[model samples]
Target: MKKLSLLILSLGVLFSCQSASSKTEPENNPEIKMEENKTMQQDVTKKKNRIVVFETTMGKIKAELFEDKAPITTNNFITLTEKGYYNNLIFHRVIPNFMIQGGCPEGTGRGGPGYAIKDEFGPGLKHDKAGILSMANAGPNTGGSQFFITTVPTPWLDGKHAIFGQVIEGLDVVLKISEVERNKMDRPLKDVIMTKVYIVNE
Candidate 1:
């Protein structure tokens, strides 16, 4: 009878220890860890890139500013955008197979924010492809608020213009704007207005 009692107590202690061990075991689920890592990576990527959207009369054009490559130019653009500087402005110049130019407050491609930002020419930043966003200037170091987005690759403008961004979305809208009717001065016959322009920090 004593032997039976001893066996029962031993079995109880063993089961208790097994339960405690299982409860104390750390959770090392691989799927949960992978999901956590992916989320963190996405957050970091969003912080690194800055996007801007142009809600035009035609359609929305989204571009990613080259902040890492052209800090000064991007900063100037962000500041102006935050201040609604490009709102209600007209895309004065539209050249098919070339580019669409805008950001002129005068709606005649002759005005700016009353001050100029020094040209920022990052290495390899060139008008080498369609959708390239570049600063427009009459001469070197003369860029102010005026800018342009190319509809086709313009290699000749390299080194003479400050290429600060590229259209990531709405390239079709840019192309549509470029196809608009224009006068001899390249000014669009019907104004392609920028109804609103804003920045997206992602």
Candidate 2:
């Protein structure tokens, strides 16, 4: 009878130890762990990238900035946008079926954000399509705040300018800007003001 009680105690201790071991070893409870992990991942927020939106007098020309390809140029533009640098700035140069250039605070072809940035041109991105946004520079590696959006394919500008982004949602707004009346300098007679150039995460 004593031996039977001893055996029962030993069995009870073994079973208790097994239960404690199972509780401590998370891998043994994969289903619970997986559910917890899923909950954790769901609780973690997804990253959101800002979409460059050109709110002009005509309409909102939404664009997706190519930060991956032109980090320097894109960062410069984003900083300028956050500072409201492009506000009230006119599209100083507009050529039908070609491009529309702006971002010069002076509203002249010769202005910038008081500094220059290196060109981000390469084989990765190019001026292959209309509504493509690119930095306007006097020469190589002289890019600043001044930029242009192609109204058509401009292959010649491929390696010359920093292709930073493209008009994803409002090409028509860009087309309208291209059609505005302009002077001999290609400066618009009527202000094609860029009311705002802002960003939206995601």
Candidate 3:
């Protein structure tokens, strides 16, 4: 009788251990699967999103556009840049220690994309300082591809220019280009064109 009882206890312990191990294994498996799914989702999102590159006459500037934050602004820029609309467009206005404005197909400050996009603001983006690319418009809701790059902090433009992308490289190029001669309106006396604009991923 004692031997039989001992055998039953051993079987009970073995089954209990197996049950515990099985339960723990399922819990860990689900967690691992959830993590894998999350990573896959992130990778898919990144792959779908594109990184835009602006090859200016001064130099190349890269910007990782935020589609999720400013979808309308980002999409507008992507469409315009991809269509070669910005190519050869002159930096019409360049104010010392202020900002440089462009996006006129005719290389004049009065040109535009022929259509306007609704303002996408309050995304925590700010036009605080230099290298911050933003929209150029006569008034709110009038932005139509005309944009600017700051040479210095233009506090007055904080809420004016719709903060889109920023210059991630070759900022000195803008400063040097701005030093070029300009008319009374700060428009470049001699046209400084953006040779070509393209998108590149790093």
Candidate 4:
């Protein structure tokens, strides 16, 4: 009877040990829980803002695309950037106290990707200040790869152009290009090339 009692007690102890081990395993451990939370937070951070980095000859200009507000315009720009279409494009037009225009493959304000995108305008979007990025269109619904960044407040353009994005980090670079020497047509005397444009925060 004593031997039987001893065997039952040992079995109970073994079972208890396994239960404790299982409870403290990696899946249930506090350290693992913290790591999972950290990873989740990192992912959430990435989805908050969509960033685009433009590597220009003057300097790098980082713009935050308004994806929620201008989905078509923002995505179109993102697509062009991913396709390497803006590489080597010069800032073909730069008017002081106004804006700098580019993304013309011909560098003469006459070239585009051979196709135009519909205007994605909406309420509350306006070209009210510097750094505002909007399509350089010939008329209504004529948006294409060509875009401009304002160097000063341009309220007249408000409610006329589709304000798709803005210069979040390099407004100074845009203003600097606006000050470059230009001809009668406002084309830069020397090329202020956009070496590349790419999406960030992937």
Which candidate leads in TM-score? 2
Give the CA lDDT, 0 to 100, for residue 60 in model 1: 97
Candidate lDDT scores, in order, read 0.93, 0.86, 0.80, 0.88
Candidate 2 vs candidate 4, lDDT winner: 4
* Model 4 residue 73 distance off true place after TM-score fit, in angstroms: 0.3
Ranked candidates, highest lDDT first = 1, 4, 2, 3
- Per-residue lDDT of 1-202 in model 1, one digit per residue for the tens? 9999999999999999999999989989999999999999988886686888999999999999998899999999999999999999999999999999999999888899999889889887889889999999999899999999999999999988898999999999999999988899999888888999998876
Model 3 ranges with Cα > 4 A deviation = 1-38, 41-51
Q: For model 1, where is the 10-residue window of minimal lDDT?
A: 42-51
Superposition TM-score, candidate 1 onto the true structure: 0.78
Worst 10 contiguous positions by lDDT, candidate 4: 23-32
Which residue pairs come into collision in candidate 4? Answer: none
TM of each candidate vs. truth: 0.78, 0.80, 0.79, 0.77
**Candidate whose lDDT is highest:** 1
Question: How would you encode candidate 3's per-residue C-alpha lDDT over 1-202 as one tens digit per residue?
Answer: 9999999999999999998898766455788899999999989867654666667766776666766677898889988988888877788888888788888876667778888888767477876767887889888888997888888877777676677777878788878777889878888877777888787666
Per-residue lDDT of model 2, residues 23-140, tens digit only: 8774667889899998887655333335888888888888888776777888899999999988888899999999999988888888888888887774578788898989999999
- Candidate 2: clashing pairs of residues: none
After superposition, the stretches of candidate 2 with alpha carbons farther than 4 Å from their true spots are: 27-46, 121-123
Better of 1 and 2 by TM-score: 2
C-alpha lDDT of candidate 3 relative to the true structure: 0.80
